[model samples]
Target: MKKTFLKIGLLFAIVGLLAGCKDPSSEAPQSEGPSVSTTGESISEPEVVLTDEEHNIAVNYIARSVPLVIERTGSTIPTNVFRADAEPPLPIPELKYGNDLILITYGELKYEDEINGVYLYPEYTVTYSYLEGENYASFEFAVDDKGDDYAIPDYPRYDAEYDSGGNPIHTVPPAKAARLYATIHIGERSTRFNIDMILHPQEIIYEFTLDEARAQPMGKIVKVYGYFNGYFADWNNGVICDGDVALGLFKINDYREYMQIGKLYEVIGQYTVYHGLPQLQWIKRVTEVAAADHPTIAAPEAIVVNANDFAEQLDIGNELSGPLKHKVGTTVILNFPLRYKKMLDRDGNPVEPGSLELGKHADVVLTGKDGNNFEFEVKLSLNYHMGIDDQAAFRDFFVANPTADIYFTGPLGAYDAITLAPFAFEGSLSLTPPVV
Candidate 1:
């Protein structure tokens, strides 16, 4: 039989051992069996004795390890600068077999010291509950680099001053390598796995321009220079543009400090297509190259489009030649005689406009000129400064005026088809038509 190795939890399993190891800590509560040693050293392999529940969990884990290893064999993993309150790593799942529960704990392991590598200090006693009737066994371990306790020299910090938009300004850290290790303890038996990951700065392509980067193949990592145009708080991303072309910056949490509207920036990331929209994901770096003293300096002007032009542009596919192709990722002012068809949720289910929920996207379908239908995804949640009552009032306006000459501004993106992603409704939407 062919042996298959898989990723059980945080790290993939390369090899498994049935030997008993030193207990994690002396302070940990003792399990209901023979007392495990606490000497912090490897002991001789003991006779294996597992109850039916323990045997099932271990069997399920060993059975599923192969594909996980193959899946993550060459995957790029994001690394963060060690912070005390940083978000915890994703949790591992617990496998269930019958009525008995099998608890798994993260054991201690040695941290590799690569040059300028970010270290992973995994918690030792994270517990997971096994749900009833599930056959698979999985576990999650929280890893963080304990603040000053394991501080390295020359680590970068955010600047004390805030930008005009109240966002803190900071310098991005250089890429580093990291090798993480963790021990998985199932009942009395333990297995160890180590993950080798390059923290950031993976194969930088600083030569590519924003437009050139867009042409590169999917999943290719590239670095581009552009100006910060706008942020989509609803989607947790921002838009950046060179003088000619614009690209969406996905997942700004790591680089939020350097984000300021109209500032020039250098971004390094993997080019990806999210729901048909071109975006850069797993952003490695966002460095402000030039500051924007005024908001209008680096902001890209929105392209004005009428309903007929908008529908014609939407009909042209992203790869085909059309006016909207060049306008993707940039803002556009759309003026159309509105005819509301229906409202839908992200999953494409019909939803009454008045019943739209907060923090969820309300995808409203509207009939354009020549009966061309396009979607307007209302992202009022992105308007962070809006009150609940104001948001509701703004939402009701769309349903209330089902047929009116309306104008709105939003970044032109594609999701299954052309979409107008309006981050806020205040200044973007108007009942009266624009002067275009």
Candidate 2:
């Protein structure tokens, strides 16, 4: 894994800091207004999906229902205690509640994917506060004890779990869902909010089955988990996974390096179309999860086919148009004798050593039994996509032994179906010398 946890690992320290500041006052504050219930009962029916207008109204109501504390900061009301670093801070009314309990101004609607469906919830910012003067409390936020003064509090920071007596306690739930509740304490007084979240089954692409993913609606957010079956082109960032269902990943840079061939991971991104193929775009998160065992990556199934079948699969125009097109992005071995053809750059020119450009593709062809040929492109920059220089050693060995059988394994370039074209990338090319 490419250190996906390295950055997230730092979040634990922030959790520890919040845990140490537990409310010490024995007398909890008396909550005024409609008290939130902790009873484990559904406010809405199971599988109820909220419409966009209803979701807006519900979110506004929840934000307004939360308590707000007013304090004098030079007669200016700042929205929240946590402020981003800026020069000569401007005047804004500070709105907060009991001992920096909750940040109402920064309320945001968030989603969580669960076994049943996608759950919606609200996220509020929490800060550290202390008694100041006779009746007021002062607050400060930070990235750490160093008092950076611009730290953002982590989500689900408020307690949502229950104790043995059924009293609401602070703890992260196993799965963050839409219809969840949070009970926060301001001094001795604790208040609970029963949040009925919006349900969007279609928006949650991670919940898609293999068949569902293929036909999922476009223009939605996806938070799905699957085994990292490595990448497509070594050029741009792309990942292939199979689990809960088979899916593809794209435009995820932060956690791409950590992705391994067989490790399980939860990826969050926007669902969109790329090059006529369905893929997750603008990936927000790529988190590793524990799986029973590494997923078994099956080798590409070899096949014997006539020229027409090969051409139809290699043709991009027919991709995803029907089942007749080859399966793109799948590994396939071509047993046909593929000559050592020249590599061409994006403009279709011969790419000499160091002449290869980034973001451009190189094409290679393989002739079939019917005297027909198929061509495929490889992005020269991607480590997975090998260049002529990369094959110098292997090419030399082939020169010393002309009749040796060679094999290559890699995903096809066509956006839809698997193709038998050779993409000389790393771990895709091999030469088994003739048996003695």
Candidate 3:
């Protein structure tokens, strides 16, 4: 977590000065506008334009006081309020009268300035409005971007840790300060003020099951409670299962090394879809539950489907519903024995048996009991259990057992078709002639 400290002393001093010296009835120049009186007669309401000094005072007062009010009232400021660069930026929340709301209607990064010939800080324009009634009065401000007429504080930056790839991780940038010039209207009188304040990121974590997490809109950060199902492919990626439903976990933090298989754990990350498979990416945290507190949970059982019915099982209307849809991210076993056909690449192109390389895959075409052709990928990787030294050894086995019965057990992944990505060669793949 990153820490952002607001200068309370300066803010309170500004607030104190404005509270004592500001006049509620002091009216600046009025803009022409139609207002209905008690008698229904039209009149102009004062649209006050405050002087430089008055504008500065009002801005400072609001900037200092609004945060206190928000904290005291337990108001939730919108997360997208400070994100000027969000794609299809979320709508600023509508203001309601009773709540202490700080509505940021518009925000943008405007300029960058160098400080003491070292650090560069970016400035932003934050236009906002708040309602005033019995609780508080309404005020609107549109601060100009040009010149140094108003003081805009430097945006704060915190030290962030970087990954081996040199990408910053576990760091959330602080929102930049913007110039604020506010016109406060109370009854028939109005005044103006200006100030600058820093915006902090408010992260909201939602607890969900694996099914619920997958149903969430893409790119949503969610926390899921489930049992760690052990890593597949590498230690950084694995699956977490809640009952029969599971989600792939990728790029998890260091805590993954301590995660025990089949243990109840809370995992937090962003929900994403790679190809057609739903997975949790950029895993932020993983915490194991105490065995005494939680009843021991076993790993989810793999749903078995015969090879002849594999295609039909996955043939739902869309990816969102049906029997196999629930099994998309979960484990599955292809039970029926497969008769070997021909080896091909992912694109169905055949290569010489001697051409396959280590850590590379070739699709093995096989015939199911119903004589329907299905593709099962075979990756030639380090398989000490099978005593296979290289791709040559894999080729010799396939050549010797040209008509072997094959069975696959692994998580069902999808691309052009539903496929099995076996994590291990020993248990995940079986040959009729056996590995020997």
Candidate 4:
């Protein structure tokens, strides 16, 4: 069996090598988001994927997806806390077969076979360092998969497991999804991602299975919190996590505009146990912006990002105190998830749905509002024929204005980044200084 696996692996290695290293500048569509394609390229000489060396490429890739979060800032991911009675269950689209709490504890380098969907990875212990001000809160997350060198949070016997769909089961119910901020450390290198969140109310609907959606007498809207990066924003932020939430992610354009990897935001998602992972469903984005003090903007050699139609720019000064001024109505949209109903149909449901209108909201780091994060429904029309999801378009949704600030978010707080929620300013916004 080992030899056969090796033979197949060797053949795949050759094919992967033949695929060649793709051009870095080349762009492709990503179902995950508008990010670059992550297909591994082949080198002239295919290197052995599983290296005896600790912390290899496989580990790094997984780490990016499964972050080593530090809750030095807060126990919950969101600072704006709502009653549990309000939100729905977690992992709205439902990745696995069981109602297990799904948690994405961490990611490490692993060699995966495209044909078999198998991952060969190493094991490492996960630990954390708590900072001051952030209280400690115990959260639950099950390690669905662990490797020879990898040890999952709970499962003790095997390195990994498979679901009915044959996909790898990796989830951890976010124990601290309600935290205000936390500094996480992963692996020996202290790999950490600082996550700060503020939870609030939103109109999220995640209960309708595909079949049930069509049978509904009327459009059933649910409410949840609005999540946005940079908790420092003065207004409410986050998305509604109603309905088959994952189905919602598919309906928006520039989904990354609503969310990203290394930043702070308020996630108003449903708190449910999917495959043993605690997760919040984001229906709308109260706001979204880059990190403050990050090298993406702060470098003396910083180059402005832009294009005729769409592009990103960096400010040498404080990211707070203003919005990254662009065109009159330039909006970044996220493709949140939403699924169809699962109700019984005699003749089966129609082959096509309204392209699956997923829950969506604009990416805004609110300049002004009462809550740190918020998401409101606005009348939006889509020109799906024009390659744009109406939900992704910018609408006069959030009432932009500034008052209080959610300090749990670091310097690049939305309130600090934006002048007002609706963006009402005659002149340029004032420069924001770095937080000490």
Candidate 5:
């Protein structure tokens, strides 16, 4: 079996796990070359202990109805008078909210780190879900002083601070933040991450009130507001959808429409960490309309969402979040594996004799799990000329020989250098099927 792993997830999802690396955002550090001038002291990476009272204070501070900054004795040092290599190391900080979930996050300085030989993927993954029992996101980072690992791909990180209109709030210098961010991917479930921002010199300026999604508006201006889900960030117009625990559908007008097998999209939708991989709510831009004057009246042919001029008034619904464990059927619908077989040869190229060769069997399906009751029309490969016509022939053959029991005999999908044709033979399952 040729296993070619594919990446699927949100634009801000996790990619690879490198040891030693703090967070993906811990790159292109702030004092890359050291601050221009002043009393340059920074927060050092230390093992600090906090009491239950302190933890509650930090939690309450973050979830406050109105954003306010809390003073940390250790963070009293300012960012003035810093040298390129004089800055301290970034540490992994955690805060337990007692009632709410725990938050373990690294500071933004890590993302701004500028050690000549040290390089980390600009990947930030902090996993924490309100969904009990299952929730965790980790990362492994390694710094190559010799710069041997340098096959860096372009993973553009969008800082939505200016509202598409030019404005600088939290101002950081201009640099690629050249850190290797791994290929993004989608997971098999929904996840969430919690981030808190702390300022230097002043105080913890503004905190997230359990709803606002914060973003880097300008160099130091961190804009905080309400975010719908942990995955969907309002900064990029991200929205979460239903039936998205597993396969997410990412869509946007600004992005390329045509999707290829290997091509990946940094889709800005709702996402979370699931089973170590980044799982996000599928994001797709769907035009929905509502009556501008009255929020309800529908145009006659208003079936299409775009039909309503006041589409902006309508809201995107939330995911079906209840108990973390929703008892699906005895077995999960997704777990019902589709019986498949590689009717083709090792060389994804067509077989000389387009016919079902001996030594080949298939897992044939009699009906679709959706009760479509569909038995695929099967056709044995005739003479090595693989094309859509062959699929047509299979349908034709199935119509003629409905009971011939001829197993599939053609390449399901074979492109240049890539041959993955897991042609389904059956639909149902045996033994213990999966559950949602």
Candidate 6:
């Protein structure tokens, strides 16, 4: 007999739990069954117990949203820093918010020592929708981190103004509560719902290995680890090249600064095939795991091809090269050199001193070993900040020697699927031939 795990939620929607918070003074309400969204429809009418895997899914969704809440509440720490505490050693959040039908659980920041006289602000307030049939809801809030955990930057800590019981007395007023707002989307409909800061559920998250993730169907949301090899700021995108395979992130936020080439990261997103290449779209989170440098990736056995070979394949509309489609992301070396083309000005005339701006476009003529030639488009590096000195040297070298056997090394990209015409990324170019 074969056993299957529960599939995650829809394409971009998050998951939610079956609990809610009520007025603390009143008795707790018993839940009749699993939650029903604002649409008044339930996936299953009978009360369904969540499986272990389902529980992990639900908890992780909540965990991902917590940082947003914390940030909105005015916490100075970054979301990644806060999330790092969600694991063991740091106790999981156990506080509950709403009633049974709509439950929200979270952990509180533990204070190291009690204060005698200092005034303290409330940690934070969250406003989240209680959507039916979902494990989590999208939330919105503002952040202002003062000094000492609160967004409040300045306020000297003085001695105790405590009573005989050793309770601290406040010199300043407590922080104001945040205004709450809630809106929920269920299926094709949208409606208003209630939100409460509730108790924390048992924290759990299932980490997937790369192999396990690759086996899942396309568009499945999963968490996996990899090292960043490429990033495109123009597209607000990046790639995680991990152990012979690479995954693309369509939108990278917060972690953009940390996504230097060769840095390790753990990312969460939906896997989908985009233009014959697998990409992780709707990227929810990217966590930097390692800042240590990784070795430069060497080209795999690239079947060297000439301009004639490329043209023949294009003419026949078939891959004359070995698995060029599979080599969509891997590095392939072109054996021949390319003749440089001057940059064109606005009036369509070639510039003599030639502007070498970052992300500027240039072209070259590929000269095959057998004398075949084809124009090849080349883009300057997006990460021009890596080495200004190197860029200047290369620019000068390019200007001085236009026919210095220009070498191209980079992850191959295709704009037209049929033509399969590839371009060289700026990160993968090397004009200075390797020292013999």
Best by TM-score: 3
Which residue ranges in model 5 land beyond 4 Å of their true spot?
Answer: 1-74, 78-338, 343-373, 376-429, 432-436
Error of 3 at 111 (Å): 56
lDDT of 1 by residue, 1-436 (tens): 1222222321232111111122233222222222122454533333445555544444334322321211112322211111112367422221111111222222332333377462332223222221111111222222223210110111112223223332435443332222222234544655444332222221225447767777876667677777887775434778887654788887786666657777787787778777667888877677777545424334466777776666666666555456676667888777665555676665768777767665555566765553445543222222332234445655687667877755667677776556766545656667777776
**Tens digits of per-residue lDDT for model 4, 362-399:** 23232221122232211112112222232222211112
Ranking by TM-score: 3, 1, 2, 6, 5, 4
Model 6 Cα lDDT, one tens digit per residue, 144-235: 22211111111112222333232435342211111112222222322223332223222122356554655556656678777776654443
- Cα RMSDs, all models: 20.0, 19.8, 18.2, 26.8, 23.8, 20.9
Better of 1 and 3 by TM-score: 3
Residue runs of model 1 more than 4 Å from their true location after superposition: 1-202, 291-299, 370-394
TM-score of each: 0.48, 0.43, 0.49, 0.17, 0.18, 0.39
- Give the runs in model 2 whose Cα sits over 4 Å from its true position: 1-206, 232-235, 243-246, 293-309, 321-326, 350-360, 370-406, 415-424, 432-436
TM-score of 2: 0.43
Per-model C-alpha lDDT, please?
A: 0.49, 0.40, 0.49, 0.26, 0.23, 0.40
What residue runs in model 6 are displaced by over 4 Å at the alpha carbon? 1-220, 232-235, 272-278, 288-322, 341-397, 417-436
Clash counts for all predictions: 9, 28, 10, 139, 61, 36
Preferred candidate (lDDT higher): 3 or 5 = 3
Instruction: Please report, as a residue range, the 10-residue window in candidate 6 with the lowest summed lDDT.
Output: 147-156
In the range 151-172, model 3's lDDT, one tens digit per residue, is 1122233533434333556566
Q: Write the per-residue lDDT of candidate 2 for residues 1-436, one digit (tens) a residue.
A: 5455743453443333322333335422222222222343322222445656445444444334433332222222222221112245432222221112222222334555477565665333323233222112223332323222221211222322333233434433221112112343322233343222111111213455333555655545556666665553342445454522345566554664687766677776656555555566666677787765434433223233333554455554534564323244444444433444444555557655344454444443333333444454222222334444544533343345444445545454433334333334456555642221
User: Which one wins by TM-score: 1 or 6?
Assistant: 1
lDDT of 3: 0.49
* lDDT of model 1 at position 156: 19
Q: Which ranges of candidate 3 are over 4 A from the true structure?
A: 1-200, 253-256, 291-298, 314-318, 346-348, 370-400, 431-436
Which window of ten consecutive residues has the lowest lDDT sum in model 3?
146-155
